[model samples]
Target: MKLPLKRLLGIGAIAAIVIVIDQASKFTVRNALAIRETWTPIEALGDYFQIVHWKNTGVAFGLFPGVGWIMPFAGLVFLALIVLFYKPILNGSFSFAIAIGLQLGGAIGNLIDRLNPEIGYVVDFIWIWKYPVFNLADCAVVIGAGILLITLWKSDLAAVKKAQPSESGDAFNKNFNAASAADKTHE
Candidate 1:
């Protein structure tokens, strides 16, 4: 297959996997745990990690509450933007593809909840002692964002390196100028 096509396919595959996993895990959590219920924390980890049943009508980390009604449309727009810019993703590096795929998957996963008015909230279960409860979709989005930052940082670094003149060339020019000055002094 052509390179761009192959890359796109790979991206699609990763996104599908993430979406599936996110949805499945959410389903299992909802089925197994009642809202506001919690399992015992693992003793080895102290309060660091536990499973809890919670729901968020807001954005990630439980922010921006009371906007549940708007999220479905927003999710649609987000997905549309991703589709529109997909060509750029295909042409970019592997890390870019992974980042886009992961973001896409996470968006879709949460979008599913938004679309289901019956649910009205995104199911969240994963908990850390000091942090708000979140779910697989949230995890995917955060990770994807982090990867995107790394990719951009690396790209910028490479560009800077490319724009810089080689040290050897600078040293050669300095030596040549010094030798010419010596010749002029002798003359």
Candidate 2:
């Protein structure tokens, strides 16, 4: 399917928003907090939510601790793959476009950090309960993936419903087969 210019623009706009928000938040945290510093937890929420200053050299939630070197390359490849498969991935679905936009923005936002030798790490600050501290980019990626998964699941279910024979159709086929068998035996 040919992607409409309007849809492409819409997706680009969403991606820009995600990147801006992610980068701005990261910039703010980097400037305001010392490394490893944690602000007091929200009083009403107990330890459920707080801001911290931490550096992550790995993927989301700080997994793969020392593999930072590969992130920028991976991000580049990811973006390229998105462009190569843009039509199929979006499939003219607005929700899929939005989801892909979020993923793309997140990938770019973190890629910038990985490529910045001065920083050499992504800034992460959001902490909630026992969850690993994360940042806005992570949020965008996660939400995008979730939206994609749900929509794909719903589409699959719809396809299955379409493929399956309806109850009345099934009944008619069964009756026709039985009638044919009886007629053959009598003849």
The models' CA-based lDDT, in order, is 0.80, 0.79
lDDT of 2: 0.79
lDDT by residue (1-81, candidate 2, tens digit) is 356676788778988999999999989888888999878656787668889998998887888888877888888898888
Candidate 1: residue 183 lDDT (0-100):
33
| Candidate 2's TM-score | 0.83
What would the per-residue lDDT of candidate 1 be over residues 63-177, giving only the tens digit for each residue? Answer: 7887767877877898787778766677778898899889888988888877776776898888888899899888988999999898876765554444434476685555455
Candidate 1: residue 13 Cα off by (Å) = 1.0
Q: After superposition, how far is residue 130 of candidate 1 from its true place, in Å?
A: 1.2
Clashes of each: 0, 0
- What lDDT does candidate 1 reach at residue 88? 69
